[model samples]
Each structure stands twice: as C-alpha cells, then as structure tokens.
Target: MAIKAVENKFKKFFYSRLSLFLLLLAVIWLSLVLVKTFYRRHQLDNEISSLKGEIDKLEKKHQELDQLISYVGSQDFLEKEAKDKLNLKKEGENVAMINESALGREVAGEAATTTSAQNPAGSNNENKLIQWWKFFFSR
Candidate 1:
C-alpha cells in the first residue's frame, strides 16, 4: 500500500509538470505566430502606401498628357503654326512684308545723321580708318 501511494504521487507530479510544459510551449508558439502576422501586416501596409504614391504620380502625368493632346488638337495652335511656318494667309487678308535690308539701311542712315549732327566739324565722307585715327589721336 505504501508503494502504490508513492507511485500514484509520482504519476500526479509528472502529469502536472507535463501539462505545464505543454501549456508553455503552446503560449510561445502563439506569440511567434502573432509576431509574424504583425510583421507581414506592416510590410503589406508599406507596399500599399508606395503603390498609392505611384498611382498619384501616374494620374498627374496622365492629366498633363491629356492637356497636351487637347492643345495639340486645338484650331488656334494649328492656325498659329500654319501662319508662322507655312506663311498661309486667310482669305481677304493682305500680308505686307517690309524689306529688311531697306529697313536696316534707313536705321543706319538715321544713326549716321545723329552722329554727324553731334560732331559738326567731322565729315560724313571720312573713311573708317581716318575716323579711328582721329578718335585715338584727338582723345
């Protein structure tokens, strides 16, 4: 009877320790699973935020391209390009072109007249070399 009681006490102690160990192991496994789940959720959130930024950039670019396309298709843009590049005039429009060489000569003549008026003693017919010599020597 004494031996039987000792065996029963030992069995009870062993089972209690085994149950405690199993419970501890289960708790550790659950902690690891929870930690892994949190890490994965954080990674997914970062990916989603990055994708949203990319989507916003793409949407802005799409809008810019749409505006460019609209401008390219506009009649005002086409008419301006035609008039400037192809020199096309509308019906009943008279295009007068001033002679660039004549305009330049007139401007040069006015400048010469003004300079000559400033220096009454200097002759307008004087050569450039003579004018330079007089300028350096007189100054």
Candidate 2:
C-alpha cells in the first residue's frame, strides 16, 4: 500500500495537464514581451537617426550663416554698400546730379495755379496755420 501511494504521487506530479499548459502560457508571454521590447528599441533607434540628420543639416546652415555674417561685416562689403546706397565718394571727387527734365516738364504741366489776387496772401497764411494746428492736434 505504501509503494502504490508513492507511485501515484509521482505520476500526478509529472503528468498533470494543467501544469504543462501553465508552463507553455508563461513561455508564450515571455516571447511576446521580448518581441515588444525589441520593436520599441528599433523605433527609438530610427528616431535618433532622423534627429542626427536634422542636427547635421542645422550645423551646415549655421556654418553658411557664419560665413555670410563675416563677409557682411568686412570693410569691402561695407564700402560697396555705402557707395551704392549713400552715393559716397573719396576726397576730391565731384558729385553730379542728373537732371530729370522730362519728368519735371510733366510735373509742371500737372501743377495747380492759384493766383494771390484770387486766394489772397492772408487767406493762404491762415490756411497753413490751420493745417499745422490740425496736424499737431491729430497727432
């Protein structure tokens, strides 16, 4: 009777279907967790690669801007800008003003004619004074 009881216990310990099913479920769960971890790691690596690329592009742009700033700050560039914009010249150089005769003739034709006899000198001065007052008050 003692030998039979020991043999039945050993058989139950080794051949229980529920225990086997639980072991299999644990292995499957572990495999799923490992797969999810690996996938997330791969996604993060791709994001890092893209961020590195963006950093490289910004670095190149920064280098270009630095060069441009250096050039603009140079005396040569300043002289060119001054000559073009302000029409500056060296000492002993004569500055000539080009006449726009055609444009002046067109403007002369469009000018209003107001005679002092019709408008009166006092009225014109009064109009100017009133305009100045209105401008100052409006501002």
Q: Scored by CA lDDT, what does every candidate get?
A: 0.91, 0.88
Candidate 1 lDDT over residue span 32-123, tens digit each: 99999999999999999999999999999999999999998999999889998999988999999889999999999999889877874635
**Regions of candidate 2 where Cα sits further than 4 Å from its true position:** 1-11, 91-139
Q: Return the TM-score for each candidate structure.
A: 0.56, 0.57
lDDT of 1: 0.91
Q: What does the lDDT read for residue 131 in candidate 1?
A: 78
Tell me the tens digit of each residue's lDDT in model 2 across 1-139. Answer: 9999999998897689987898899999999999999999999999999999999999999999999999999999998898779999768878777568977976676563434346778988898899999999988
Model 1 CA deviation exceeding 4 Å by range: 1-15, 94-127, 130-139
